[model samples]
Target: MGERYEYVPHRLLRRRVRDIASGVEGELMAVISENVSGVGAEHWVELAYVRGPSGREFTTSVGNIESAPGGEAG
Candidate 1:
């Protein structure tokens, strides 16, 4: 497959950014740059689905990362 997705959120770990999504959690292989904003902010992102429960198939999204945007999401 020639298609590739970027890990805007995960890559920002340098900015002290760590995100967790539903049905998925923990470290991922690597985060790449899908789209970078002129404002130095990430609009869209793709995660490698580092950790997940056994027998569970789920995809990661920026929405999940935005929900908390850091941690302790209500």
Candidate 2:
């Protein structure tokens, strides 16, 4: 994994992040891990829960998040 991916989980919590594909920006509320089985093995994926400005909530993959424009977490 690249350095950016490694730091994503640590830096994302309570911070404003944007969903890369959907262009949805919000404050990240939590990160959840889920296990999956594939190819004779198991792996975990990170899921991020975010709340948007209008109080809308959604979940997206951690891989889809990036720091929101403007600044750090308020």
Candidate 3:
């Protein structure tokens, strides 16, 4: 793994994470596969789905988050 790679794939899903940029703490709801099409090509990527305290759902890059403090029971 690279020195800056902090995303632990197996352990992050359904866990709590804090968005380092926004400071919004929420549950790491899921990692979903998304298909994208480009110029004569196609690819898939995993996006992190998160639910905030207000019940809003949004997708963010896994690199933008970290494990929430006080462990996973949030």
Candidate 4:
């Protein structure tokens, strides 16, 4: 038997996610929200999705919808 500590893949991809929702609650700041209750006349949403291109396409949440104070969302 042998132990494996090394591994190789064809490609490597990494992402980082951060939520500043609580910090900008009702403050005209950018938010990542998703309607978990479904789309309707009375629907609520939660802060989900990351910041980047093709939003909500990755494991991240809250992006491209708004800017970070003095910066723009990329």
The numbered model that scores best in lDDT is 2
Q: What local lDDT score does residue 45 receive in model 3, on the 0 to 100 scale? A: 62
Per-residue CA lDDT of candidate 2, range 1-74, in tens? 21222223557688889988789899998877766545655576778888988898898888898999763836
Give the total clashing residue pairs for model 4.
Answer: 6
- TM-score (C-alpha, index-matched) for candidate 4: 0.19
Q: TM-score, each model? A: 0.28, 0.69, 0.71, 0.19
Q: For every model in order, what is the number of clashing pairs?
A: 0, 0, 0, 6
Best by TM-score: 3
Between prediction 2 and prediction 3, the one with superior lDDT is 2
Question: Residue 1 deviation, candidate 4, in Å?
Answer: 63
Residue 46, model 1, lDDT: 52
1 against 4, candidate with superior lDDT:
1
- Native-to-model Cα distance after best TM-score fit, residue 46 in candidate 4, in Å: 2.2
Regions of candidate 1 where Cα sits further than 4 Å from its true position:
1-24, 32-45, 55-58, 66-74
lDDT of 1 by residue, 10-47 (tens): 53232222245353444343445455344654554554
Candidate 1 residue pairs in backbone clash: none
lDDT against the true structure, per candidate, is 0.40, 0.76, 0.72, 0.31
lDDT tens digits, residue span 1-74, model 3? 11321233647777888877788888888776566545665566667778999999887776787898964664
Candidate 3 — number of clashing residue pairs? 0
